[model samples]
Target: MSFKGEHHPGVQTPTAESAGFRFNHTMLRVKDPETSLAFYTRVFGMVVLRRLDFEEMQFSLYFLARLGEGDAVPDETGERTVWTFSQTGLLELTHNWSTEDQPDFAYHDGNAEPQGFGHICFSVPDLEAAEAWFDENGVEFVKRSDQGKMKDVAFVKDVDGYWIEVVQADRMA
Candidate 1:
């Protein structure tokens, strides 16, 4: 089947053909799996929905998701892979084992001089409570909600220096 498409300059509407798509997962390359996993699971309450380790490739992939209340993660790989692909919001952490020994190694956080990728954001119910929890757990904040001119918006850095924006779901501008 062949179809032709035309571009409408001023049209700002979605066509029916594009309505069925859903945003899947975002992947972040992490230097250390232990610290990154701990920061995400412990701080954000995300669970490892699936994990794929390539021993020969010297790397591993960890799929994490914040499963809703009463939702259970499947123990079997077949069921888990299906479940992982069915969700819209998911975080994938890729761990390169070789980075474990490189203490001074770092990833481009995107907020540097030549910024390209911005950051990943999480919407929480309560901004204040989340901020306090992050502070208590020693999570480094790139921009606190109350610091900048933009209120109720904050950014925190992960173990790999990747920025993760934290905002109140009901209070976002």
Candidate 2:
């Protein structure tokens, strides 16, 4: 299948060197790790696959993923680290020390002027149920499924104001 619009000249078929390449994770800098972690884990039901701390650098990295049924995390640290890196659709939250203590500290959410990075998305089984769950959890909504012209897509904001797009893929079809 081809796209409707004119294609880029630089676009080419995948090469053997890129055969095994996969999107690993997208990193977002957060002001507070605890708040961001709680929102991601408790609200989104994502599991913390691995965490790394650079004491000398005064920063920490938290890797999270939504695992499927019967998926098991490795008991060994090295194995778990390897396993964490191998998974797709992971979210990495980076926290620099002492940022949380500063009341004025903020991260650019890329929704304002000169917008660039937009949002991360999650596909749900039921859009209505997910919207209800987000409402119950007191999540800040950017747009609801029934609110906009786009009927089946919703957007919610995290603790640090990063947008998360929610959609029911089956309904979209």
Candidate 3:
């Protein structure tokens, strides 16, 4: 079952009609907006690109991104919304009302029994420094970089117990 060559025989190349298609973002449901926001911003240095509140739906969609240098973020609401959707690798956190108040409430992290969604990954410039920073911030590690059989790779759990895989690209090379 080695997919060394073409994985899908039917589609040798991308469809011409889908040339403009781009991966927008990955959405994850959070129990508490405040806690989740803090974890993403502090740990990953992501900025809130846009936040849409659906009062009728009783949920809020927060779009966050790790903006690079000279990345322009429109201040206007409509423009910001457009910019947020145009970017790739964005993280969207959906917070439902009253879920934060429920002390026993928790989202299945997709790593347990009957697992579906696995985890999101973050490639860091410096693995050692990032691991130290995670330690300083009291991040819970599922597997340290040097702990398991896999070297130069780590997995840490967020406040919501979501596994975030950390890796250094250069190390893999």
Q: Judging by TM-score against the true structure, name the best candidate.
A: 3
Candidates 1 and 3, the one with greater lDDT: 3
User: lDDT per residue, candidate 2, 1-173, as tens digits?
Assistant: 66545568886777789888889999999999999999999888998888999999999999999999988889899999998888888999999999999999999999987898999999998889999999999999999998979888999999999999999998888
lDDT (10s digit) by residue, model 3, range 65-165: 99999999999999999988999999999999999999999999999988999899999999999999999999999999999799999999988999999
Q: Give the residue spans of candidate 2 off by over 4 A.
A: 1-10
From the highest TM-score down, the ranking of the candidates is: 3, 2, 1
Using alpha carbons, what is the TM-score of model 3? 0.93
Clashing pairs in 3: none
Best of the two (1, 2) by lDDT: 2
> Candidate 2's error at 2, in angstroms?
14
Say which prediction, candidate 1 or candidate 3, comes out ahead on TM-score: 3
